[model samples]
Target: MTLPFFVYGTLRPGEPNHDAFLRGRTRTERPARLTDAVLYDGPGYPYAVPEPGGVVHGDLITALPDAYAELLHALDALEEYVPGDPRSLYERIAREVIREPDETPVRAWVYLAAPSIATALRTGGTRIQTGDWHSRNR
Candidate 1:
């Protein structure tokens, strides 16, 4: 699928990996939120753990059509996501996110915490109360 991406952590603009991975590759990036998921702090990044009644704040990114395939492969590699790999750090899944302001729904690829990580996080991880990784420090 060549859908847009919903980035919530290091991949968001201004984050460390943004320029290296997303800069000119995306045609548009706007505020958006993923419902039914919560944000948690990872070693150096953040993870989105699916949870009932949860929400995560982030941006919805539209990749330039020509760059879609390359970007997809790069991102999957960056996230260490191999389809059906149990040990992967994250799993890329398609989910509906609500675009900011107008609240339009858009289907985008969201990198979520893999099963093992999600289990550990649920046991004893520090949740970002505001649901926004950028606001976690503040």
Candidate 2:
């Protein structure tokens, strides 16, 4: 079965990792949003955490079934998500992402920082109030 992914950081279009990881693997790609999630700067990357009134900007990409596993594995590695590892930098989870312009909701895989990491970021990391990694970094 094919799966969708909500990419907010390096995996978004034009980002350094996009071409390397998703360019030819996606069946569809469009702007999308994950509501109620705060974005924080993690040096070269961005981390997202669930929040009551936050909205994160990103892209929703559908991977072809034939490439899904490989794509997901590559993404997991890129996000440093080691399954069952407490020390993983991010946790891969399924969440509802709203497609942009129309606001249609779809289930998609998303990488989120652990609560403890998010709490630390809240205290010391730079917050991307706009929820746009590209804009904040640029």
Best by TM-score: 1
Total colliding residue pairs, candidate 1: 0
TM-score of each: 0.97, 0.95
- Give the candidate number with the greatest lDDT: 1
Native-to-model Cα distance after best TM-score fit, residue 35 in candidate 1, in Å: 0.4
Model 1 / residue 126 / CA error / Å: 1.0
CA deviation > 4 Å runs, candidate 2: none
* Tens digits of lDDT, candidate 1, 1-138: 679999999999989999999989999999999999999988888999999999999999999998999999999999999999898999999999999989999999999999999999999998999999999874
lDDT of 1 at 13: 91
Candidate 2 clashes between residue pairs 3 or more apart in a chain or in different chains:
none
